[model samples]
Target: MKPNLIAARKPEEAATTHPTILRTVLEYLLDKGVQPFVGDSPAFSNFKRVVKVTRVEEVCEELKVPLTPLDDPIEVNGEIFRKIKISRKVLEADKVVNLPKFKTHSQMVMTLGVKNTFGCVTGLEKSSWHMRAKNYDDFANLLIDIHRIVSPILTVLDGIEGMEGNGPTNGRKKNFGIIAVSRNAFALDDAICSFLGIDHLVYTVKNARRRMVTPEYEVFGSFSSTIQLPSTVSTFERFSRAFSRFFVKYPSIDKRRCIKCRLCEERCPASAIDISKQEIDYQKCIRCYVCHEVCPQNAIKLVRKLI
Candidate 1:
């Protein structure tokens, strides 16, 4: 199940996929005589620890289903990415079930079905991709390539409670209360984007349109809520190099809120953050917002480079 457990610690927070949904899906699969196992590679800690914290371990135990880390990377050369490493367990699986949280992302806009497959890359490789992809569109292309490879048979979105405003983590948990299912993830994402009135906004949707992977689709369900774009979205819209020099949005540390946990420094792919002195080197910063993504304290804030 692809829950957004990136920085979640509690079930009540609804930051990740609700455990109830996991249990229900697992039970339904079991009833259909499907030998299903749950696997995800979280960016923060060990898979077991993260599942335990999110209370997913209990459900898996009670259901007697295997909960695993999508590890042991197997190299696969893609059209856009060469020697890309992915989880062997996932590669060997008969079919993948895309269980994504309907959450807004600081970098990619929304972490929908197409974006959730990034978990298959495993371990630090996910972080390195941020460095390898030179810009927003590049990163979206990487996600698309991986999604095409994973090729999940079914996608079930946990849109019951959506996260908005600087998310994938550390955002408001909204009650959207809708579940979306589709076979083609691209179409599913496209439909959601259309429903949210942001078909032109999400990077993956834009890239999918360019590649023509997104097919004609219709959204049946009706749900309403205003999505809050990430704070960085405003400055990022001006993509021109000249505009970037003056209006770039960068991550800044809120020292008082920071507990010196060092998660951001340890996980920074660019190695731009120095938690010891509480500073980030702007020249080295890649604007991946990874520090913002992984920060447990919500101490990282996105600020404009220029007034």
Candidate 2:
């Protein structure tokens, strides 16, 4: 099973999947005579540390399952890009179980099942996509293309506790207290959008609609919450391209809170951050917010230039 273990943040932060859920699913798969393994490639953090901090390793230990990082990349062609490298283990698996957290994303409106599969891209290679996709819609399309090839049979969304306001990491924990299962990730994400009253606000859902990928599905049960999306999430459907740069939010370092970890500098695709000086070169910056996403201290703040 692949779960969203993007960082070493605690399970309480809702940044990653809880170990309890991983265990429950692992046991069920074991009972079905399925040889299940747990794997993911965290974008910035070390895989061993992320698994340990999220306690996913504990679950794997208890279940006697093989827990490993998604390594040994193999090339595959997607509809959008050729020779896309994915973990060879993923392609060789008989069946895949996708487990994604319910969280608001600074780039995409939400990170659900489809986004979870992106973890298959293998470690730091993910950073380059941020530079290439360049926009929400393109990134959404890339995610969808990846989903098509790594197609999982089932997806279980963990909504019991979720992140809001600049998440996947670095956000507030929200108690949504709901769980959902689906056969199709696209439909699952679209349904959640309807539930959250942001059906059209998500670029993934919008592009999925255009591509006719999400099939019709009925949403059972109910959930209600006023989610605090990313600080700059308003840019998605509200403004014209010409004005987006003027109004779009960019990352700024709060030097007082920064710890000089250099993660922001190391992981930034644009090489715009200099922790020594606590500066960002906006001219070179792609506004990917990787610095903000990778920062452990939450020192990166979102600001608008007004120019």
Candidate 3:
């Protein structure tokens, strides 16, 4: 998926669920006779090794919970999808508890409950969806479709330490000091967006509201701080309606900064990236920001597409 740049923060500080919170949830599930399996497909193919470095393996071991890697894919049909591959274990589970980290996403505007479930799409299949849905609107719809298929029973947002600006992976950490839980992830996500002063018209929010998928819910906590949106979004906001109507932003590889690792090229869903020439085929590019997210050297940058 992507690499985290903040070296000062531990796994929790880097917008992941705190070990204490995870332990509490697991304990509650165990007490209720629900066997909980700590599992997810990490952004990269080497899910096992990455989890260890991120301390997920350690945390699961300390809590005596089995860690399962979501590598096995199960093709399932949805309203908007024909043969999307999702994790088999996720499909087999009686109930799913979503643990989403509150963060600003370059593509989705923000990554909340619904966006987090995209991990169920398996490693490369997650990228392939980007190929199909090239823009925010279609991508958001794709995410909603997958979420509908998974239908997690509960969603717990890790907002205690959240990320703002360019995020989901690379961004500055903010002490949001909040945790939200709900049976309806869409409602919880909407509440979070409202709290952060982000526009409800964001693709996910708009779609959820349009479909009436968001359930009735009440927010118990309040925060007054405004979040810093990604540069691409904030830049678009500064433009007048006329100028903004035509501009598009696409990722560019900083030739000077790239180390030729080809991580972005490999993860690219549409196969538009060429590491040898360090060029991205904009025609085939999906604007998913996977290139920017996976660039280990911080080489990929989002630039406005010239019309």
Candidate 4:
């Protein structure tokens, strides 16, 4: 089996950092005679659009690797996942390596190696999962199921420069200056949470733990001293005070940052969001945090409230 290579993105570099990361990933694979393919399943948007925006195609061309799009739909357990696809080249290759950005999510707490795979699920179908999984634990299990199917041979996190505040997209970038890799996605995430000093109880990691999928695997690479992760902020602290019933932190619209674009309302699966009033109905909200994740303006924040 070819070793999977995961690379980290350094913080503070211009967008040019992607190509450098891509080169490192390709080099590692080429050295082992593994054919490489690159792709991701971004939420609420088309993969082609994200690749174009991120210039991933250009990087693939320069590296002489194939830029494969996941276009075929596969039904796994009657899920009817349309275009529920992955890079065929990658699946057929000796190994599938992942390159994920490091970042904190308004929902899921931190979007690291595992959460990054959500991009593999394909377009609009991704949002329907949000609707189907409705609550945090269910969503997390769904994520695990997806991970089981797409099973990356190895994962590398680009923590050199990562997002914080509210992310996956829509957050300020922070410099973590670390590159981490592991064959065990769970262990890698546990190590990352430890490095960041954040709580592992965050939904995704917690679910991974329950499933016993942690990073008990060996690690390779170096760190610039131990990375100081931000302290764990509880869901209560980050959620809006108004929507307390959901039991998970839901983002509050930052009046100053909010352009009232209604993107959050449109993407919300629970139909809990009321853009007209700019209020979320907690009873209806599932606390998926898709509202916070998809906001382009960084207009949403999680706030804690006294019960």
Please name the candidate that would achieve the greatest TM-score relative to the true structure.
2
Identify the leading candidate in terms of lDDT.
2
Off by over 4 Å in 3: 1-15, 237-242
Window of ten residues with lowest summed lDDT in model 1: 235-244
In model 4, which regions exceed 4 Å deviation?
1-17, 78-94, 218-232, 235-248, 254-261, 274-279, 305-307
User: 1-307, model 3: which lDDT tens digit per residue?
Assistant: 1112112225754645555566677778888888788777767547666666566667678767788777689899877667888988889888888887778888888888888788787767777777778767778888888889989888887778888887766777988888888888898888888876675546798787777777788877675667887756745554463566467678998999999998898989888999999999988886778887776666988888766
**Each prediction's whole-model lDDT (CA):** 0.85, 0.87, 0.75, 0.61
State the displacement of the C-alpha of residue 80, model 4, in Å, after optimal TM-score superposition. 16
Clash count in backbone of candidate 4? 14
Model 1, C-alpha of 161: deviation from truth (Å): 0.9
Q: Each model's number of backbone clashes?
A: 0, 0, 2, 14
Whichever of 2 and 3 has more TM-score, that candidate is 2
Candidate 3: residue pairs that collide: 1-43, 1-44
Candidate 1 — which residues are off by over 4 angstroms?
235-246
Residue pairs in candidate 1 whose N, alpha carbon or C atoms collide under 3 angstroms: none
> Residue 135 in candidate 1 has what lDDT?
92
Q: Model 2, 173-224: lDDT tens per residue?
A: 9998878899999989998888888867788888989999999888887777
lDDT of 4 at 40: 52
